[model samples]
Target: MASLSEEEQQARETIRYLVAASRSVPGGALASAREDWRAQLAWWGSQGYHGVTLPPEWGGQGKSFLVQTMVVEALAEADANLALLYEVHNTLHLEAVWRYGDEAQRRRWLPDLLAGRRLGGFAVTEEEAGSDAESLATVAVPEGGGYRLSGVKRMITGAGWYDQYVVFARVPEAGITAFVVEADTPGVGFGSPEPMLGLDSTPVADITFEGAWIPEDHRLGELGQGYAIALDLLDGGRVGIAAQAVGILAACLGRSLAFAQQRRQFGRPIARYQGIQWMLAEMATDFAAARLLTYEAARRRPEGERQRPLYAMAKWFASRKAVQHALNAIQIHGGRGYLRKTGVEHLLRDSKVTELYEGTSEILRLVIASRLLNGYNWDSI
Candidate 1:
C-alpha cells in the first residue's frame, strides 16, 4: 500500500464504516424498486463521498485527489457501483465546474451538487464518435443569445434520473462547445435505461437533444472549448477509475485470501495447496504494483505535468489487473465464486467495464504510444 498520512488513514476508516452502514447488495436492489438504490446513493453521498475532492466552500472536504482516491477505494470495497456514481459526479461534473465555471455559475450550482442535493451527469459519448473526438456528431447552432443543441448521447451514467448534465456539442461558429443542460429543458428527452451487466443500481441511457435551447449562461468554459473540457474530464475520470480498479483488486485479494483459508479440498485448506498459494501471491504482487501506479498518477494530477500520459498508464495497468485479479478470485473460490450471492462475480463484471470505459484500454495504449513517438522520454520505460 502507498504510504498513507494520518488523515488519509482516518478517511479510509471513516468511509469503510460509512459504506458498511449504508451499503446494500446491488443484486437485490436491481430487483427492488429504483428508490432502494437511489436512497442508498443519497445516504452514501451524504457522507461527503460525492464531493470528496471538491472545494471546502461548497461543503466538500477540499482534500487532495489522493485522499479522495483512498476514500473511493474504501467505499468501493463495499459498493463499487455506488462508488462509480460518486466518482463520475465528482470528477466529471464538479471538477468541470471548478475548472471552467464562472464564479456566479459555481455559486448557482456547486452547493447543491456538493451537498448531494442535486445529481450531476456527463453526456458526451455518441455512437459514431465512441472514443474518437474527430468524429463528433453533436452540434450546437447559435440562436439569438443562446444555442439550439441537437444530438444523441448514449451510455450516459445518470441519464434518466440526473438533475443536470454537462453535454458536449460541436458549435457551428466555432469547434466544440460544452453546455450545462438541465433535465427540465424542453426537447431534452431520455431514452429508456439500458440493461447493463454490472453497476445495476446506476442507470445508463441515451439522451436525445432535439433542438434543445440553452442560454449562453449555461455554456461551460467558452465556445469551442468543449473538446478540451471533455478531455480534461477524462483525465480525472481515469484517475478515479484507476482508484476504482485498485479497490476491486483489494476486494478480490481479501475475498480470495479468506476463501483460500476457509475452503477445503482433499482434506486440506486450499491455501495450503501450492497452486492456490501461487495464485494468491501473484495476485498480491500485481495488486501492489498497480496500486503504486494508481497513487502516483493521483499524486501527479495536481501538478499538471504530462498528466494525460501518466493517468492513461495508471488506468490501463490497474484496469487490466482488476479484471485478472477478480477472475483469480473467482477461480480460487472454485464453483462457489460463480454464484451471484458470493459477490465475486459482481467484482468480475464490474472490473471488466473499467477496461472498456473512461479511456478504453485500446485508446490508452494508442495515447501512450503516440506520446512516446512524439519524444516523451522515459529511460525507465
Candidate 2:
C-alpha cells in the first residue's frame, strides 16, 4: 500500500471530524443528510477549505488534482450526500465557468461559488434524453441582445435548491450552447421533487425554462461546445461516484463482520462458519480493488491523460460491487437487515443509484469499447 503525504493525512483528520459531526445529527434519512451537508459546507468555507482546486486568480487554494481527489474521498467517507454536492458544485459548475466561461462570467460567479455562498448545478438530463444527451430538444432562440430558452430539464440534481444552473440548450445556427441561468430568472420554474430510490437527500426535480432569457455574455465556451462540456463534467463526476461506492462498501463490510462475530448459530459464532468467512473475504477483496481503480483514475487527471476508459471501468465495477456487497450484508443479518432501524436497508437502496447515475453500466462499457477500438495507445498499461 502507498503512504499518504502530510496533506493527505491532514485531510483524513478533517474527514474524521466531519464524520463524527454528521453522526451527531438526529435523523438518519436523506433530508437530515442534506441539512448536514449544508452545515459542513458552511464550516468548510469558514475553515478556508473551499477552493482547493481553482486558480489563484479566482480566490482558490490552487491545489492540484490529487488534492481534489483526497478531499472528495474524505468527504464521501463522511457523507455521500455532501460528497455529491461538492462534486457537482466544483467539477460541473465552478470548473465549467473556469474552463469555458468568459472573463466577466468567471469573475461574477467563481467568487461566490468558491466562497460557498452560492450552490451550482448542471442541467443536461431530460425526460426523453438521459444517456442520449445529444438528442435533447431544449431550444435557445436569439432574442434582441440575448436568447430565450424554453425547455424542461428532468431529474436534475440540486434543481430547485441551487442558486444557479449551467444549462445546455440547442441554438438554430450555433447548435448546442451552454448558458448560466439564475434560479430566480423569469419563466424558470421547478417541479415537485421526484421520489427516487436513493440519494433522496440530494433533491432532484424537473426544471422548466419557459422563455427564460439570459444575456449573450452568459454563454459558456464557443457555440456547439455543450456536448464537450457535458462529457468532461461526467468524467469527473464518475470518479466522485466511485469514491462514494468505496465508502458505502467499507461501511457494509464493517457492519457485516461485526454481526458475524457476535451472532451465534448452533452454539458457535457465525464467523467460524466457512461460508461466512468466504463471503467476508470476497467482500474485502472487492473493496480493495475498487478503491485502487478509483484512486488510479484520480492520479491520471493531473497528467492530462484521457482516462475515459479507466473512469468508466472504475465507476461500473465499484457501483456493481457496492450493490452486491450491500445485498450480501443484508443476507448475513437475516431479518434484521430488512428493517429501517438496522440501516443496512438504506445502504442497499443507496447502492443502486450509483450504477444508474453518471452514465449507466451499459453506457460506460460502450465508452470503454470506443476508446479501445480507436487505436489509442495502451502503453500506459
Candidate 3:
C-alpha cells in the first residue's frame, strides 16, 4: 500500500494505540462467551472506538470511513470477534439508519447506538431467504397509527441481545418496509441460540414478530425502499469485511513468523530453512497484497460513483486470501497449529467466517461479474 497522508497516518496510529491499550482486557477468549460480549462492546465504546464513522452529534468521532476501516483492522489484529462486532454496529446497522432514517429517528436512535448503551440488530435474513433478501417472508400490515409486523428473522447476529432491531418486512401496500422495532415489544420474541464454528462471541439466533406494533415514525426510509437501502448498505459494507480479512491475515502472519523464528527444527531455527522462508515470504506478500486491495476499496468507496465492482473485488480477494493464509499458517505450524493451544487454530476458525459473511466468496464473484458485464467501472478493475 502507498504511504498514507499525515492525517491518515495519525488516524492509523490512534486506532493502533487504542487496540494496544486494550491488550490487558480479556477479549479474545472472552469473545467466545455470549454474555461477556456485551461488556466487551461497552468497553470499546468507552474508548470512543465504536463511533468512528458516526456524526459528531451522534457520540461518534465523526471520522471518515477510511479511518473507521483502520480502526476495524486494528481491532481485528487483536481480537477478531471485537472487529466483527464493531463492523456489525457501524457498517451493518448504524450506517443504514444514519443514511436512511429520518431526522427524528436519528436523534432518537443514534445516541444509545453510538454510546453502546443499546445494541442494534439488522433483521433481514430469513430461513428461506439467505442470499435472496427479497424473498423474506416477514410482513408488516397497517394498523391504527402504526404497523403490525409478523415474521421471523433467522441468523440475526445480536438477536437476543440487541435493544432495538432494524427489521425489514413486506407491507400490504408499501412493499418491503424497514421498521425500528424495540426488542422488548409486546410481540417480539427470540429463539434459541444457534451453535457456530467461529465468532461465538457474537451470539446468533432468530427473531420472531407476532403483530409487533411500532409507530409509523419507526419506518427507516420511504415505504418500499427497504430492499434498496439494505442492498446499498451491503455494497459499501463489504469494505469492512475486506479490512477484517486483512486483519486476520496480519494476525496469522505475525504468529506464523514468530513461531518460525523461535521454533527449532533440523538442528536450527526453521526460519533459516528455505522451505520455511518460502512459506513466510508467501504469507507476507499475500497479506500485503490483501491490505492494498482493502485500502483501495476503502479509499474509493465513499465517492459513491461506480464503485460497487471495486468493493466486491476487494471483499472477494481479501476474504479468500484470509482463509487461505490461515490454513497455510496452520500448515507451517504442523500439528501445533492444528491444536487450540497454539492460537493458530483460532485464527483459522475465525478467518473462515470472513468468507461466509457480508457477501460470500461466491456472491462477491457474481456481484463483480454482473458489474463488469454492465461495463460499470470496467477500466478501474
Quantify all predictions' global Cα lDDT against the true fold.
0.83, 0.80, 0.82
Error of 3 at 116 (Å): 1.2
Clashes of each: 0, 0, 1
The positional error of residue 63 in candidate 3, measured at the CA in angstroms, is 1.6
The CA lDDT at 124 in model 1 is 84
The segments of candidate 1 whose C-alpha lies over 4 angstroms from its true place after superposition are 24-33, 377-381
Q: How should the candidates be ordered by lDDT, best one leading?
A: 1, 3, 2
- What's model 3's TM-score? 0.95
For 180-225, candidate 3 gives per-residue lDDT tens digits of: 8888889999988788897656678999998888889998898999
The C-alpha TM-scores of every prediction are: 0.94, 0.92, 0.95
Model 3 spans > 4 angstroms off: 25-32
The residue-by-residue lDDT of candidate 2 on 162-255, one tens digit each, is 8899999999988888999999999999988788887758788999999988889998988899988888878877877887788788878889
Ten residues in a row with the worst lDDT in model 2?
Answer: 22-31
Order the numbered candidates by TM-score, best leading.
Answer: 3, 1, 2
Among the numbered candidates, top TM-score falls to: 3
